[model samples]
Target chain A: MYGDQGFTIFDLQLWAEGLGITFGVFLSSSILGLIFGSIIGLIRYYNIIGIGRVLMLGSEFLKNSPVLVQLFLVYFGIPALFTIDLSPVEAAIITLSGNTAAFIAVIVISSIDAIDKKQLEAARSFALSEWQILRLIIYPQSLAFAMPMFVSLAINQLQVTSLVSVIGVVDLTRVGDIINQRTFEPFIVWPIIGVTYFVLAKLVERIGARLEQRFSVHQASSEI
Target chain B: MLDPAVMMEYMPAFWDGFIVTAEVSILSIIGSFIIGLLIALLRISENKVCRFAALFYVDIFRNIPFLVLIFFAYYGLPEVGIYIDAFWTGCFTLSIAVAAYVAETIRAGIQNIDKGIIEAAKSFGFKRVQIYTKIILPIAITSSIRPLGSVFINLILTTSILSAITLGELTSASKIIASTTFRPFEVYMFLVIFYGVLTFALSAVIAGWHKYLNRYNEA
Candidate 1:
């Protein structure tokens, strides 16, 4: 085996590119998951036809299984089963989004439940439509209640994004592995990589705190 | 193109892998629990240094991903002249990594104790040790059992990453089976379901235990 290759400026470029991919995948998957999960949560809340139970069961499996296993299933297993060409990034996004959605569903259901039934009943007395009640009452309160949890979950999901590297996605963790293999400097390489993630998470936490403060204003109900 | 019958031949091998996973999980659960308790105690200590150190430990561990930590322990330790095998490395890393979460959960439990209860304990002339051991800890831990159980369940899931370090755990064994059988899809899918069912059962038991312990506090 060749001794560890010395570090180069090119390696820094690779690191930046890898960071981009990691954040790109994390952002897209999170937004998509939130959309799908809110829909699932709303369906459950409204008790839609025959499918809510099935959806919940699906989310449970998604929630409970290890992300690495889910990644493998999507990247390797699905291609072998269906004879379809799948890029590592595509598989990573699909799997991570599904996983994120599962958690979002749980949060959505609980946050909605946190709102008062009396609020809905009161809205009904005012000749308000269901949609109007949802938009005017349930949305603001549930979002306020859900803010802290959403922030924590976002931070956790950023860490979870590292697992995508296992499926051959050239994310930050994979970049670290490549550099560590070449440089033979585990101590230097990994701490840098880990610190990158930590800082990103801290950034998310700060923004979330700001959002939480803004939402806390809505937490106080009007006397009208 | 799915065939379930192929798995029948690999059942014994899978069983062996399951045993390893179970062994490692049990050991780490115990290891982390002890560490978690100490750290949680440190977090609430009267001494400022102890509290700061404990918080720093928890912060670093919680922020970094488990895979990164596993790689660090598995590879970085060798450089520092500690030559443990993959199995021990996996166990040690999992314990230390998970202890962050366990400490936080336990700290929350401890903090959730009603200030009034501790004041009453002080009025009873129970000293600090008695207040902690006899009065506060039991109520805190029992009340927080459900959250603590989730931490354990997460610890079990984290064990699957040990396979990445080539520790012949359930995932690694299944990897071999999948390659040999030419059915990667079925093998991994089965593994997903198996882990899902395992965690679901563990959570159910934890819920039951929480209910039983909190029977007196139920509204």
Candidate 2:
């Protein structure tokens, strides 16, 4: 029972565009999160003045709360309070990046803790500088330890990207919502959207596994 | 500017919303725990098909976003003549969705049981069901309180997503007050702190419970 305004080639174009936006938002937020999360982790690691405690407290709030509320706070709340312009896409990126950074900061600290304390002591006795110890002793091992957690986090965050649609970003979920409203085909439309996300998550898992293996190999060879 | 007076005026509505959130979270916690326990059993069963089916359920639910799953339940169910309302829809989807996570946690707990204990139970003439209920599940469940607590805390946060379906939960209520008060900043900022404190207090209680349950192991 194909209606006159049923699925068309242009829907395909819209689908592709939605996929691109989803990937764009996910990738940009993830990279920014990783960078900022690392900085937060390092500050805590160094116990740099009062800033570390304040940053950690902020991160705890970020980690504990729902990302949806965070998105609304940034999108609707901040702009209204400041009387400034902030688009939905910008708000989505800002909120997701902060949320991702909260989780990543925890992962970084835990992974670094996973490394043996004696390794740091050995490096210190060998007259290694702080930078040298971090570079040569701590970094690689922690990366290996953190890889699995990172992969799982990536998968979780990819699924989280779906929430951006609530704030009016035309991501994959929003595309499904639009088509479903028009076609009245929830069964057909939502499944396609769900499968797209499923496939994307699987891809992330596959690449993460590969990266995990590579890091483990590097750790082993470098150990010798 | 933050306005305490504006927030005070909306306290009644926010309190009502918080009650709904608490109700849904409690119901879903019980629901997911039961479903997850069953799945964990099926996952570790001797039957190959049971294990495979359990694995498939976990994979599908875990990979798909909760919002997609909620939309499917909300919209698709009505079309199929199921006719469940939004509250039940949120609870149903959440129970099943969070069960995937609960199942994984319980399964991990189950697998870590010592093989000798199972054999000991068997040698003492315990039935398979008896062995599972009395020996395996007790140990696994007691040891997993901490992890299961985190899962439940996460489930509480996820109830906010139910707002999208017009369920009038805490976030939804906050949205209404924000628009009415024209103080989105103060409203959402308070909401954030509210949720953060809620989770922090929960995890603290859970940590105490976990420690109490596993106190024997510490010695």
Candidate 3:
């Protein structure tokens, strides 16, 4: 009986709108996360001032805690504490970005460590500046090492984006919840929502594979 | 302004929620390990149908968000006349969903076992079941203790999502307390630290156990 109410042209629009919001938030938060996380990673790598220890502790807490609690803290707690206006979407962005950044910082730090110390010393002996050494020696190798971890993290973070719906951002999962409630069709609605996420994940995997291939070409050439 | 009086009043409710979280997590860890081992065996089975079925299960469960799976089990199971309470539903869904991840990890551990060991077991006239139970499973378990522990820790964190389905777990109980006391910040911040410390402590224990298990292998 509920199936009779299901297939409308407006549903397509709703799906599109939801997909747009999901991708929009995912893309923006990922970029912001990468930038912020990389900076933190670099700071830690350089052991800058006394702030790196604090940043490390902060990020460790962020990583260890569940994202749902983080979402609640951002969505409900922050506004209550600060007496400021924050929309659900804003809270979603803030929480997801922070979550993504925490993971990214870990990835960046590990990848940087993977670079050979001997190579760095050799570059220094040749009188390369710190920026030049980083650019010429560290960036390429660390990027290669970090690519796979970044890809996996990106995929995980994409799924985590679904949690944002709980805070009332009308992302794909929230859209599915809304439609399912109205139509009472959990089976159909949730499957559609789940498949959209699966496809997005697959897309990320494919792109990451391509990048890994492209970056690993240097190793291939050297071997030949 | 800080309200010590309100937090003090809600401490009992928070403690109750913490106990429920611990109970659910412990049960689901055991449940998932058993189910995951079975699925991992099925995945490595010679029968094509069994392998395909295992793959299908893992693909579907791993791709779908845990929240959606919980919703489906919580609501759809009741529709199908399989009436169960939130705690059971939470445990069941968690076991089934997390088993996929655990299965994959175990499969990796199994595959990493040296083929020479299997050959030696076969040469010694060990039956297939004996070999699996004796040589293969033990090796996989020892090597996989660390990864499996992390997976279980993640499963514990995921149990918090069960709160959405009315499971009165830590997060849900804290939500109620926070709304009642209008101390959202303190409540959630405390919840976050609570989870962090819980997981951190579990990982430390796991690391110690892992080191102890692998001590003979170390030089």
Candidate 4:
């Protein structure tokens, strides 16, 4: 039922480019989120004077609110308020990273708490510095505990990358929008886009499962 | 640069948007719960077809983004001769999408039930339906109140996405206010805090109710 403006070979290129953008944005934001989120987690773990509480409160607001509103605040609000030019991609990265970081902080804290208090006491008796204790006794165990959560979060964050299309990011979803608009073929266009996302999510799930398995082994071996 | 004065003038608009959001959330919460319960039952049913069908539904809906699902429903529905407004479409799509999460939560609760209780019900000659309705559902639901609350809270947040189809819910309302006042930062910041507080308050209430309901177990 589509006319000459129907699907074209060029559409393949557009789809590929959209896929690249989606993956690129997802990777960068997830990495940034992990770093920042770990920092927040560490701060809370150490109980830094005043900064940890403030950061945790900020992260709570980030966690509780919708990412779309945060996107608008960073994309439209920040530029207007700060008089700085902000691109859609930049705003998306900032918002998604902050959001991911908020969740990550909680995961980190809980995983560390999962470690035994006795381990900490033993390390103290050995005259291990706080840094040494964290490095030796806490890091490996908490990481193994946190692996499954991180994997699920990674899968979640991948799906979240789709939201960038709303802000004119020309991501996969945006490409589908463009193609669907031109072709007036919602069924054909959306299913393709949806399948692409489905495959990606499944891929993440598979990879995450493998990593989870590896971490579980590491955790088991470390106990011995 | 931060202007409370502008926001105060726009409180009515925000309130109107909040009402729409509340309507969508409340309706979807009920819609999703019923649908989710059915799917949860289907997932654990003895029939292979029912089990696979329910699993497929959960997998597809959970794996895909809600935005994409809503877009499909919004645009694709009319082509097949189903005409609905943005509000109903939003509620319908949100119900189906969020129901996947709800089903999983409920299923976990169902599976976690003590096997001995089911055995006892069977020994008492309870019909399958009776066991499900009189025993299984009540226990599963009560135990899962907290997870379901988070799921519903997430449903409330997902309503903002309906704006893409022009539903004019809270997020959409704030979008309009931001453009009109030319103060997106303040508008969105207020919206963020507004949603944050709403969710926090709701979660706190859910926790209390959960504790109250499970007081017997605690004792």
Candidate 5:
């Protein structure tokens, strides 16, 4: 059993599949989180009645709690209580995306606040409507300010995706666990898994830096 | 639909787990604070090698997930003939992993120090050590109290990961209660709120402390 299991090409296929799942969950959840979180942030910015404060309270707990516990709640707790079928992958996506939204919401609010109010007033004086002012004046500057935080958040969330494995999502970490169990070589298996994540993080950082530079350029050119 | 009565029965076991979590958290906070402070200092040191080493330490730990690092320590240590229980391994891992965060915050704090103040201390005939102990570190550390508080709050939350190694921390203990009581939803939901409230209360206090420390400043 062990001889056939030792470093097979099939194992490499498994690793690739697991890495794909990890990246897939990460990218889709991040996109969803950004859209939902921005809406929440916009609600808060506009001071939407009752809804804003309730959303804020919910996100506060979401942000403060451990992601592992949150995963268990979504994966195990939700199905049992709600009597709904939630596969591991679905649960991972739901939980990670919601978690990401909570964080991105905070970043959105703060970055919007970081925009100078006089800029908003100046746009208003130029007879711009509220929606036009948001699109033309507010969006670009706040996005530039939020880029660095967004980058860090992306890197952190990528690592947080590892927890999905505990819920049985067969991510890279779970694949490592499977191979380690079969071969009983923790020393080799774990380092390989660790380096894979490290490289992914570095890649995210490089991409983020490029995005930041581009946004800053946009801000600079607009100011001129 | 959570029965508070059912949850209450597990309080004794949960309390024991809370004690373990508290011990690991306190030890790690102390450990990370010292290690982070040294690295923060090293990052600002004159020698290029020291600076590079510090940067390497922060980069590796900060990017790698704590779960991975913990798995590495928990599984890899005994393979090399270094046997230790999950408790110590957890404490050690948390300290090293969290120190990266603490060091970054402290580094930012140290860099924020006014150059004129350091120059003023030097001109006042204070030795280099005195300048650091008296003028530099105090201002840097004080200014960074809020950020460090958040870091420590995060460290407390990270303690939950120790459960994966079967260390019987809060998460592990609750896992038992959940299974035995057949109430995974209720048990974990309660645990989530427990941690959320704990961190929320902590950050509030840290904010007040930060404000108090900066009260004398005109800035």
Candidate 6:
């Protein structure tokens, strides 16, 4: 029925706008997730008082549960409970960031653990403060180790951004839904949206591979 | 604001929703595994067309959001006059989506198998089908039990998304409870914890099973 309506130029603008929103949300939340997750990881690594345990428990819940539920809780539930207004985009950002943080924290913790204890001890003996050791020793190595996992997590979180459409945020998926409803062309509409995501994921994989190659060059040369 | 007391009365409805979620999750898990196994085989097939087809399926399904897939199936199936209920639609979409991940994991497991074992099987005069069924599959499944378990756990978490299409699963059930009781916070808090505990328990079982399966190989 909608196929007869003919594709309008307006649909192109809507798709572009949707792509912008989706990428905007993904980039912002990813940055927030990295920062928040690293802090949580550091706290757990240092075994900071009772707060470490609390953060770990909270992160566990965040990681284990569905992001859709988390979105609903933050978007619909929280405002009702606290009597504060939260726009759909704001709620999506908060939930996605928290969800991404949980996964990122796990990656951070494991990557730090990959470092040799003896190396840390050696650094300490060299008069390196805890902060200095973390900055000069732990950060670089852990980042190299965490790069692949972080890349994969970023891709997954990008897909998770589609769920924001369910709560009325007009992201890429929502834009597809709008066009599909009006045009009633599931065959054409969905494939275009799916291809866009596929291309974006491929781009992420390409960038990640380049970074991985660059980081491993030192080890590659040393071995030879 | 609705009274908290009124919401307490809908516990039965919420429980019913929980039951539906559990049922759909269980059914879909089994369906995905069976389908995943076949797709996994196709992915590793000697025939180039089979391999390419499987790769295409996995790539497209994996890259696309599950919500879009579900919507397509939910809407598209009816347009073609193939009517099915919400539960089946949810299960079908989940199986298709999850099979992509399962195929990837299984392909990895199959690739990791030692060449020596296959040679030995050939030397024993085992037919190609027999070798796959009797040896390759068993080895691949055992080695991949842990990864497969996580994939299934993720599938369970994904079942919550089915609520969007009116499946009345856990999240949808809680949505109704939240609205009716005007206790969105309490309802959703309970749901988050419920899903967390469910997934945690599933992962623990998986970890236990992985340990058991690899007991002889332990360091």
lDDT per model vs. reference: 0.90, 0.93, 0.87, 0.92, 0.91, 0.88
> Candidate 4: lDDT over CA atoms?
0.92
Provide the TM-score for each candidate, comma-separated: 0.96, 0.97, 0.96, 0.98, 0.96, 0.95
Q: Give chain B TM-scores in order.
A: 0.96, 0.98, 0.96, 0.98, 0.97, 0.94
Clashing pairs in 2: none
State the displacement of the C-alpha of residue A143, model 3, in Å, after optimal TM-score superposition. 0.9
In candidate 1, list every pair of residues with a backbone clash.
Answer: none
Which of the two candidates, 2 or 3, achieves a greater DockQ against the reference?
2
Chain A TM-scores, candidates in order: 0.96, 0.95, 0.95, 0.95, 0.95, 0.94
Per-model C-alpha RMSD: 1.6, 1.8, 2.0, 1.5, 1.8, 2.3
True contacts kept of each: 0.73, 0.85, 0.62, 0.82, 0.73, 0.73
**Clash-forming residue pairs, model 5:** none
Q: Go through the candidates in order and give each one's DockQ.
A: 0.81, 0.86, 0.72, 0.86, 0.76, 0.65
Expressed as tens digits, the lDDT of each residue in B41-108 for candidate 4 is 99999999999999999999998988889899998999999999999999999999999999999999
lDDT of 1 by residue, A2-112 (tens): 447888899899999989999999999999999998999899889899788899999999889888888888888999999999999999999989999999998999999
Best by TM-score: 4
Worst 10-residue lDDT window, candidate 3 chain A: A215-224
Model 6, residue A25: distance off in Å is 0.7
Compose the digit string of candidate 4's lDDT tens values, residues A179-221. Answer: 9888888999999999999999999999989888876764874
User: Which of the two candidates, 1 or 3, achieves a greater TM-score against the reference?
Assistant: 1
Per-residue CA lDDT of model 5 for A1-224, tens digit only, reads: 65226677888899999899989999999999999999999998898885988898889999999999999889988887778999999999999999999999999999888887888888889999999988977888889989999999999999999999888999998998888878778888888988999999999999999999988864773466
Score candidate 2 by DockQ.
0.86
Candidate 2: segments with Cα more than 4 A from true spot: A1-4, A218-224
For model 6 the local lDDT of residue A203 reads: 84
lDDT tens string, model 6, B8-91?
Answer: 677788789889988988888888888889999999898999999999999888888898888888877887888999999998
lDDT of 1 by residue, B84-194 (tens): 998999889988988988899889988988899999989989999999899788887898889999998888888888888888988889889999998999999999999
Q: After superposing the true interface residues, what Cα RMSD does each candidate give?
A: 0.8, 0.8, 1.2, 0.7, 1.1, 2.2
Expressed as tens digits, the lDDT of each residue in B21-57 for candidate 3 is 9899989999999999999999999999999999988
After superposing candidate 6 on the true structure, give the runs of residues whose Cα lies further than 4 Å from its correct spot.
A1-4, A218-224, B1-8
Candidates by lDDT, descending order: 2, 4, 5, 1, 6, 3
